[model samples]
Target: MSVFAGHRLTCIRGQRVVFRDLSFEVNAGGLLLLVGANGSGKTSLLRLMAGLLAPAAGVICWDGDDVRRDAETFRGVMRYVGHLDAVKPALTVAEHLRFWAALQIAPGSPAQPEVTTALEAFGIAHLAELPGRFLSAGQRRRLALARLLLVPARLWLLDEPRTALDTAAVARLDAAIADHRRTGGVVVLSSHAGERPPEATVLNLDDFAAAATEAWGWREAW
Candidate 1:
């Protein structure tokens, strides 16, 4: 089981600062929710945690190792799912999953059985042979999520994962997340929707409104 720790995180986008001195820790088997309004730096915070963006100040440590110092090593233990589905329109559902799975020397392969299981779990089994372009928005989202089952990483960084999912699909997503937590996997997600797994800790980005307001000067503009 691995753990992620961020201390005094500070991020800047151009002249505007997103956060300052923000810190949090998430261990394996835990879930953390990042909540905030639009343009409140929720995505920025997640990117920082995923090591896609560098913090202007402070450090992100994974299992006591500085992620910035060794990003590849840190990324090896983590999986990041952004708001956009990284699926190729030319590929079928199974092909998409297999492609991503082949890139990582991980525990599971996104072969037919596992792909079918994941698709069935998300109620997208019927779309297995369909190309990414042929699926609906919701179906594409499910296909993207199916990749998670194929690649078992200790930490998961999800940004609005429930987008475009139906009620049943949402329930399935919640169940999958719960199961991941039970298996000692860590998750940190940012979402405007109130849907969250049971017993998950909440971190409202509004708590840093003062910093955001001060950094962006929205008070004076509005």
Candidate 2:
């Protein structure tokens, strides 16, 4: 099944138009990479797919339903991790996972064990009690990613997911994404980093640069 289908999506920021008439389908078990130079609307497109930002035109369908019409339902089936960690500095690693799991409305009875297993899978179980503010940048990134394992979401919209990570952390992220794809989860991510798995389909934003200019009628900024 197609987890996400976007048709002629257009987004405008101020006088500059970003994407124009962009269309793509991400099926279950598929991994898609969005590659572009800085300020090329990669993040805007990701946000549109995540249902965080509405497109100025066209439709984004998630699991056969219009995301704009049924945002709550669409949100229930997807998870989004942006460039920032979104962790509460006062909370511990375990607390952060539990908090996000709750927000995702994951089944409460299994939340604790699920959080524990996710931390262990990322090799951060030993730091579970550490406060979010005290953890290193890499550790915080892992904790943000651990939210995915705690709750099973069919779609993942990630922005620069590999930032602030060591070699081992990058390996762990690759393995996690591989595992997700193996289990029929779909991922759409924007990254300037050259760390994507071999199977991912690359969508270069430069191909749409002219379209953006035509749609927005502005000079190229990037």
Candidate 3:
């Protein structure tokens, strides 16, 4: 079993201490949900995990090996879905998936079937020919979520994935997450929704706020 862990992580963004001394671990088939008020370190922590930002202290390790040692390799095994949708105005829905499938899937393998499957998973198969600009907010969000199914990755880092999703779309997302976890995939997401994947471990950034205040004399509230 693989383990992804953060030990004593301290995040400082633009001279503001977001959180400090935060530690957590997720084993294979595990789910970790980050919850906190806006301005908490949830997104920051997710970005750190995705190797987009460096931790001011501590390290992120996969099976005891520091991710920084080989970030490009580490990134290949993970997928990150942030607040922004990656949709392009001119690309049709299928084209968008094909673009990503090309990058994530192996060379020579046909990507159409996988793209079709992903579109169906998020109930967007009908929109496959539609341009990204024509889709609704909910549809765009579903398309973003569908990318998860197009290729296999061990870790999924999502930042507020439920943002524009309807109840049904959210259910699809929950199901997708469940399926991923069943396959030993690790998921870390920040959400404000009442419903979440079952048996998820919670990491509330509120718990780390005090440490940041005390350690850095940061007084402005998040």
Candidate 4:
């Protein structure tokens, strides 16, 4: 089983100390949900796990090996979905998914079938021919979430994954997450929604903010 852990993680963005000495762990088949007010380091924490940012102190490890030693290799096993949608304006829905799917294919990966399956998973198969410019906010978000199904990755780091998703779309997202977990995939996501994947473990960054020192003029941890 794979284990992803942050030991004594202290994150400082700019001059502000977002959080400090935070430690957490996620194993295969588990879900870790990060919840907090703005600037409480939810996105920052996710970025760290995604290997996009390094901690000022402590270490991030995978199965006891330092991720920094080989961040590229570590990222190969992880998928990061940030706040911004990287969809292209000119690409049709099918083309968009195909582009991302092609990027992750190994030497012998069956590429075409994966793209078709991913769109169907998000219920966007009907929109396959529509260009990105024609989709609604909810549809775009659904497309972004569908990207997760395009390739096999053990860790999924999502930032506010429920944003702009309709009720039905959110249900699809939940189902996709459940399927991933069943396959020993670990997930860490930040969300404000009341409904979440069943059995997900919570890590409220709000609890960490309350324990922070106010001397630094951090002005209410965001």
Candidate 5:
């Protein structure tokens, strides 16, 4: 029963507090859906879980060990896909995946098969020989999502992953997520598109924002 948990997390950017006392937990083979309005700290929360941004207060733990203490190991077992599509205009789709695989996969493993499988999973196999510069917005997004299959990570942190994806691509993504969970992987995602994964636990950032403001006895002026 591997568990990834966050306790009483408080996120602050510069002088403003984004969310406070937020907590969540996801067990192996579980999915968490982050729901909230824009600027409600969904992205910040994902970044916090990914260790890209340290929490102002609280801890994120993996199987009862504090992630901050073994940041490298925690990072190695998780992948964070952010809002931007990280594609290089100069590299063909296959090249880009191969480059990432070289960094993520074990030295002696056959990464090419994994690369092709990932592209195929995302329905982007046909785009493998195409330069990133020529890809449409949907194609580029699929290319970014395909990285999830390139490596075996325990946890996935995705921010707005469905953006720019068509119906078919979205279906492929949902299927990929389901398969990952079946293999004891965990996923935490934010989507404004209102698409929900089956049996996902929902956490609303707006609740945290309201609670934090009331706890502090302050309100922002409009």
Candidate 6:
């Protein structure tokens, strides 16, 4: 099985240090639930893991190579769903899915059936013809999220993915996570309290913060 590990990660924002000396690991078929209060660096950590933001210190490694060294390869294997719903307002839902799916596939790829399945799972199959501008907040979120299944990603880095999803849609998302894990995929998702699945690892950013603070206190005392 494959492994992804972040060793002694440090995140700094402007003049403030958000977090430091944080380490976490996720194995293939494992789920990592990121739990923390607001401004606790959960989003920053996810973005860092996605290779969107560079960590001030430490390394995120997939297998053995540092992800930052080959961000493109890391990105190819990852599906990062952030808070923003990045969609084209002029494109219909199906077109959006098709366009994204094609980019991830080779030339002359067959029609993607998962696009329809994802739309159905998100309960937006009926709105597949609707433009992005016509969709409600929840619908837009679902549409953005459905793109995950359209592409094959070994690592899923989700930032508050359940936001704007209905109860039924949440259930579907959970099921999808389970299926992904069963197929030996790794998932890291951030939530306030963190809704965990079976055999999932939990990372509390507060623990890291407290540990960093405690270490600073010890150094000062000594």
Higher-scoring candidate on TM-score, 5 or 6: 5
Among all windows of ten consecutive residues in candidate 2, which has the lowest summed lDDT? 104-113
- Per-residue CA lDDT of candidate 3, range 1-222, in tens? 448999999998887789889999999999999999888889999999999999999999997899999887787788899999999999999999888877864434354548888999899999999999999999999999888888777889999999989889988888898889999999998987665568889999989974443445445543
Sequence-dependent TM-score of model 6 = 0.88
The local distance difference test score of each candidate is: 0.80, 0.82, 0.87, 0.83, 0.87, 0.84
Order candidates by lDDT, high to low.
3, 5, 6, 4, 2, 1
Residue range 1-222, candidate 2, lDDT tens digits: 677788888788787777677888888889889998898889998888887788989998887878889777778788888988887889999988887777776333354448888998788999989888898888999988888888788888889988898889888888888899999999998888776667778888766654543545444554
TM-score of 3: 0.90
Q: Residue 53 in candidate 6 has what lDDT? A: 85
lDDT, candidate 1, 49-126, per-residue tens: 988899888998888888889777677678888888987889898888777777776444323436667778788878
| Per-model C-alpha RMSD | 3.8, 3.4, 3.5, 3.5, 3.4, 4.2
* Residue 94's lDDT in candidate 6: 96
Which regions of candidate 5 deviate over 4 angstroms? 105-113, 210-222
**Greater-lDDT candidate between 4 and 6:** 6
Clashing pairs in 4: 38-222, 39-222, 40-222
Off by over 4 Å in 3: 105-113, 210-222
Worst 10-residue lDDT window for candidate 4 reads 210-219
Q: Could you tell me how far off, in angstroms, the CA of residue 56 lies in candidate 6 after the best superposition? A: 0.4
Model 2 vs. true fold: TM: 0.90
Go through the candidates in order and give the clash count of each: 0, 0, 0, 3, 0, 0
